[model samples]
Target: MDKSHNLERHLMSRKGEHNYSATVIWTGNSGEGTKHYRAFSRDHEITCGSKPTIKGSSDPAFRGDSSRYNPEELLLSSLSACHMLWYLHLCADSGITVSNYSDHAEGRMIETQNGSGHFEKVLLKPVVNIGTSDDKDLAKSLHDKAHSFCFIANSVNFDVRCEPEIVVG
Candidate 1:
């Protein structure tokens, strides 16, 4: 029940490594198959085992369908989801009873003159609602640890900043 014991148990349970995989199938081929620059579509499908296929496409700036999910948006969503999951886990282990949690994350990408671009920064604004008994300071402090442990955040070259707000409910 104590903090130290809980932290120790949490650390001990994650000693093993993990692996993940996914498949992307291009469904474009608008009957021409890249014969010209505008001949083919950028539509594709992403699948992971038995899960539902995610409709994917290039950004509309690249002549893709605006109705589909773009790669840039997916990358930002991955980072946001990873951070939120780790934060919730850490809160549970640390005895912070979170009633509600939400994040409005944003990412900024800069395109170069050569038509290539990279994400410059990502801001994760997490608003956490915790039980009245929880320590608000401790809840706020956990965001740093969560970001440090997030796999997607650690893999990205751009800076990922967390601006968390803690509310006792």
Candidate 2:
């Protein structure tokens, strides 16, 4: 099988639009913290609550504080999450099983004269740990294949890179 053909085929795949809805209500002092959000999508309603890092454990809604993950985090985290999901799907289709997938995503917001330059580019350093049954060469191929197949990655000018490691367990 020619490698370039695989890339071309992946590139030619169609892209579709996605939509989501959410709402959050703020409650006073001890009732609920300022970090509350409701996300609704495809038969799932996620009532997100932040970790105690933001709201002190002494508070009643300590777990629902938005201090743990801010808006900036959402930006980077979503990018990392989207990339990982696409990569995982590509790997599975390519007959590769991923044992673990974690990413260290970071971005810089340049305060320019115009205002603020949105996260111009983010560095998504993903460390993919694969199982022993997976072949190293094949795993590398799948990782490369996934990088090309990820829609969010291609959509953004951000540089996303994966530094994968294998651990046979």
Candidate 3:
């Protein structure tokens, strides 16, 4: 089963089903002795989480007073996850062995322009750490390819930055 004839591309869509939605259960324990909780929506009812609270209404990681994954933080995760998936696929197709993978993403939200008083301009920062037994150039190229093919990165109108530091171990 050589790789030459196995070349193929694919298409994927998320949230396609009307009843599909991920609700991260927040049990009021943030692993650091803090009470935080919230939930997402799939329909009109927003009664998933404990509602009407000054505390459990936000994400702790996003500096939210409570603890639910914020829309912005979810954006960062989506992009990072997409990049990681593509990176691994590219590596496998290129016959590269990846021993480790991790990405820490951050987004900077600024004020919206045109007299809008809300925040805007999310700058996605993805610091990727990967270990591979392939040529350094190939690894770098795979990173580049992943960045180029990441759907979430292309769907947004923000400045997405990928600082890929590859290592062979």
Write down the lDDT of every candidate, Cα atoms only.
Answer: 0.92, 0.59, 0.60
Across 117-145, the per-residue lDDT of candidate 1 in tens digits comes to 99999999999999999999999999999
What are the runs in model 3 whose C-alpha is more than 4 Å off?
1-56, 59-63, 113-133
The worst-scoring run of ten residues by lDDT in candidate 1 lies at 1-10
lDDT of 3 by residue, 1-169 (tens): 6552353423332324444333444444435434332333211112324554221333444345434445556577888899889988887877877777777666776645663332244333344344544677777777778888888888777777777767776
Question: What TM-scores do the predictions have?
Answer: 0.92, 0.58, 0.59
Q: List the residue pairs that clash in candidate 2.
A: none
Model 2 TM-score, 2 decimals = 0.58
Clash statistics: count for each candidate:
0, 0, 2
After TM-score superposition, the amount by which residue 137's alpha carbon in candidate 1 deviates from its true location, in angstroms, is 0.9
Best by lDDT: 1
Itemize residue pairs with steric clashes in candidate 3: 58-68, 110-120
